[model samples]
Target chain A: MIDNPYYSHEFHGDYELVSIGRLDLEEGGSIPDCRLAYTTFGTLNEARDNAVLVTTWFSGTHQIWRDQYIGDGHALDPAKYFVVVVDQIGSGLSTSPHNASGDNAAISMSKFPHVRIGDDVVAQERLLREHLGIETLHAVVGGSMGAQQTYEWAVRFPEKVKRAAPIAGTAQVTPHDVLFSRSLVEAITSDPGFAGGEYTSNAEVVAGLERHARIWAVMGFSTEFWKQEVWRALEFDSKEAFLEGFLQPYFTVMDPNDLICMAWKWQRGDVARHTGGDLDAALGRITARTFVMPISEDMFFPPRDCRAEQERIKNSEFRVVDDVLGHLGLFAVAPTYMPQIDAHLGELLDGPA
Target chain B: MIDNPYYSHEFHGDYELVSIGRLDLEEGGSIPDCRLAYTTFGTLNEARDNAVLVTTWFSGTHQIWRDQYIGDGHALDPAKYFVVVVDQIGSGLSTSPHNASGDNAAISMSKFPHVRIGDDVVAQERLLREHLGIETLHAVVGGSMGAQQTYEWAVRFPEKVKRAAPIAGTAQVTPHDVLFSRSLVEAITSDPGFAGGEYTSNAEVVAGLERHARIWAVMGFSTEFWKQEVWRALEFDSKEAFLEGFLQPYFTVMDPNDLICMAWKWQRGDVARHTGGDLDAALGRITARTFVMPISEDMFFPPRDCRAEQERIKNSEFRVVDDVLGHLGLFAVAPTYMPQIDAHLGELLDGPA
Candidate 1:
């Protein structure tokens, strides 16, 4: 494993591992002895039926969902239901390009294989059924890339999921977004320090990572966020202050190979592949009661795109939530963000399958 | 100039230059022995009162406004008025870092002086009065940075201009746009070939230039443009083709230093400097009849921003033109783009001042 102190469990708290073993990928190839990084909250009853699965977004780990949205009095109260947060493969904490050591060294760094949204669902399904001994999920919830996987869980294994919520993400990626993600991939490879994915450490590729972060700064936040000087809430007096203090430092510590891997997959996230590019047919397979939640000011996945996908799923509700931070609102930057997610999720979890 | 065939008169057609001597700058220092590159259509009448000034946007020369909006049937009819299209300083064709040799070598490459929107207007005014022997302008028309210059012309020399039209631009760039332009700067500087703005040639910094191009691809076009597959109209099969065939080659030929110099000025394009940061006061100085024309889909300078500024101009009308290509519609990518501009300009040019 790459000895990076920044993303250790110390930085994100504790997590456990579950080996699903030699899982095959949707895009051809297999992750030999693949292990999934995850953490659970509350307890699984004797009936093994009160389990909920939470997937992480890009660059996020199992710890993101903890404390912020899974506490008592919240919709995802761990005291009431067993909440399992799974770190998606290639997410650094899992079998990422940064940490594929020992029996997994063959897929390390540049040697890693391509992954799809479907591959993450397949592996997580194994972790739940084989390792944790759960047959059906009470609900599956996530935001951004996690949301892409949420739709996969709903459509691929329709009968197994009781409810699903895919927030700030679309089932089939838009042409605009596919091009947007390409910019991130180009930023990494263009860096000379990348050295064709043979860099000794993340520090070597700091220039490209900083470029990646700056690109995100332009698209992640809503126009209103910058117009109203919302960075003041984040303690930044000027936009330059936010660029230097918050943005540049955030991505500089990340491994570019892993990020490029995610970007490639993110660009290819199409559940419509199941029905040969028929998005309506793919969404029609979703049997679970669902909430298609999109942040109203989100630049990446606008509300109009989310509403179109929501119309395809029979039992789905179109819920538009406010978040001035736009796509980055998935971080719960808005004070109302978590509370709103709780209300929508609480209702779906309590309703019929 | 820099021996760049792409920007030569053979490519852009006929143009001329006029020396305005040593001109003072808005942000301190000066472009010593500065020259303004320009092209004129039709004829200067004996009266010279029918003269109009057309400013070019960033990366544009004196050719863009020709044929598209300055023909016999269009709004800027050369037969009716002497149309002078002037390329702004640091725009490669007009005393930019790339070609700043001979007496202008002191401000060449990395040693180029910082510029503001007001500087261009001041230089253009001197060219009109000292060289061209014109005391007043019938109207001033421009888009993007060109728009920024148009506002400067109206407010700085209120008595000199009879009409002004600032299209797809803002008097003061928003905080969101400031951060967006920073990404472009970062992309170039982060490339190893940039060598701290000391690159041997534009060809050497192709990687950085391509990254610069890709960033533009994401923000230049509107969501509807991508959703509707607008590139198909341009004969590109996909967005990736548009990236490689168009965007990359478009920027890779230009000197990085010149591009960065333009970007710096573009980010700081605030006419509010005239009234100590009071936008209302700066715009209130406009005695010319004006049309604050913003593209309906322009992401960079949205209509709402233009509307806000129009309210401040005593005789200004807010005109929103639809263009699916967004900020890039300044290139006339939308079929309706030039017509809408012609309609608005015709009204302002024909009306009483």
Candidate 2:
């Protein structure tokens, strides 16, 4: 659909891309000839009931789910179920602003159409039904923006997801969360090299990306992380070195325009829009066995906010991962949180809700 | 001293400027012919024993004390005390990178010399003794960066200060504080319009300054403020309007170079530096009857951090101002905090330690 080199459809061993065709957006626009990049492991059972959908976080590809969550004896085990990791639309591997074509050619850079979590779920549904022939998912698991999509899947198509786990994210974005997302977008757009988001290469906006990474460093982890000098764990000489070596390098490769598009969606994350601003009703529509997992120290999406929504969702369980890593605990950085997540996911997947 | 139009020495009614002569910086280098803009209110007593020294916060001038704290019945009552409000050096009205001359002429913009909180106190001390002909201050009061300077005055020149009230600020910049300060500086420097700090006007780098202001909007207030939509109190129609009308306009007039210079000083704010890096020994040097007032909802300088230092200081009391406005409570926005501050200052000035 598109000839852009930035669009990475290359199959890295098992990773594959599926064309979902033209996508009508939640807002008034449409993305023409859209495609979703995804990866799968293990065999779909003969009954077609052993499929789990894994969504990617902001600026993360499907690789994160594969590398972190999917393994023998871990949550989302390939031995038990066929796990599908789908890259969200704005993610570089998907039909992002950097790679969309046909009628969507004008959607490049700053003109990228506004996307919502609902729209992403719509695209993801088509990918599952048309490409993978998956009528229903055994479970849907995600954290952060992925968690936002997981909530959308449960709310938008209730019967499609049997069990849902939304981690370190919420069905609604609070004013504080909106403010944090806005800062990240502002950090990228304020760069003079951004040139109104028409920068030729991501390299031109490295400074803004670095600053964005710095914001993440402060907000992503709890104060105790900095107090304990956890940067030392990363084996960097100092905090500044850790920032340069880890954060800067990690974010610099991301397309700034894609980040902006994702942030817009992140800011407008309330699922209540579907039910006429009735958050309780929107959450009430979920029939899946839901587990709302929030990090105890997460300043952005605290456990209290997550618990509020979890309480509204019928047949839902609220679990807080207690870790000093804050919002980052969802990434399974420290060994302290992985077992908790694994046990919960294992219960959701193997045991009765 | 310096013929920079950016340096407003002309008296704007009550506001006036005083040349403090050449100021040798604490961190090497000298600001040749440094000038400090200040304003005075009420009358000096016959014995000159009623002098109260008030310092400026980051980006604030001498006028903040005049408008907020120095009224007939307010905290720093001009009727009962000779209130001297001195702008911190690097604040727009003072001898900052925007106005410095002589050897410091080349120190314009990013090349501005490093200045610590001790350096600002050193300059303030000279201004009080030489220009105002006041050897001792009945009290030194300030909030935020101003509070940092207040602590420096008590610890560095213990005999000169009789009473000190440092509000919403700590004597040392914690790693958390440093990260915040660093983000603000990086936000400015990352802007293409920054041109390595060689920008001609503030308007040239509005985007960066606006980003910096957005960061403050999130960090300066508590989550409760946003949750309750406190911007309505400021008569704004919406949060977006408040950002555009208040935050943007307020910061746009400020020189970016001056902000960067002040942020550099803010990052290095450790009174421990003066006492061989021993925080307890440095706090122990404070003979001034001190009131360490930290805003209850302030995430930046939490009451715990303030109380820890207060516990180490001799003749000091810790009072947490119970308010939801967070660090902004120090600005006296809500009627709730002003009375507490007024009561504290009244007792500190009138009663024995």
Q: Estimate each model's TM-score.
A: 0.97, 0.91
Query: What is the DockQ (computed on Cα atoms) for candidate 2?
Result: 0.61
Clashing pairs in 1: none
| Runs in model 2 lying further than 4 Å from the true structure | A1-13, A41-43, A46-50, A101-111, A347-351, B1-13, B43-49, B101-112, B347-349
Best by TM-score: 1
Predictions in order: lDDT? 0.86, 0.83
**The CA-based lDDT of model 1 is what?**
0.86
The candidate that achieves the highest DockQ relative to the unseen native structure: 1
Local accuracy of candidate 2 as per-residue lDDT tens digits, A1-353: 22334345442335687788889998988887787889998989988989999988888877667777889979788999999999888887777877756656778767788888888899999999998889999999999998899998998899888999999999988888888888888888877788788888888888788888888886787766776687787688888898889877888877888888888888888888889999999999999999999988786787878988999999989888888888877667777878888988888888664
TM-score of chain A of each: 0.97, 0.95
lDDT of 2 by residue, B125-179 (tens): 8988888889988999989998999999998999989999999999988787888
Scanning candidate 1 chain A in windows of ten residues, the lowest lDDT window is A1-10
Each model's Cα RMSD: 1.7, 3.2
Instruction: Please give, for residues B1-353, the per-residue lDDT of candidate 1 as tens digits.
Output: 24556656777788887788887887788888888888899899999899999998877777778857788989899899999999988877777877888888788778888988888888998898888888999999999888988988888899999999999988888888887888787778878788877776777788888888888888888877888889888899987788889888888888788888888888888878889999889998999999999988776688878898899999888888888899998888678888888889999998887
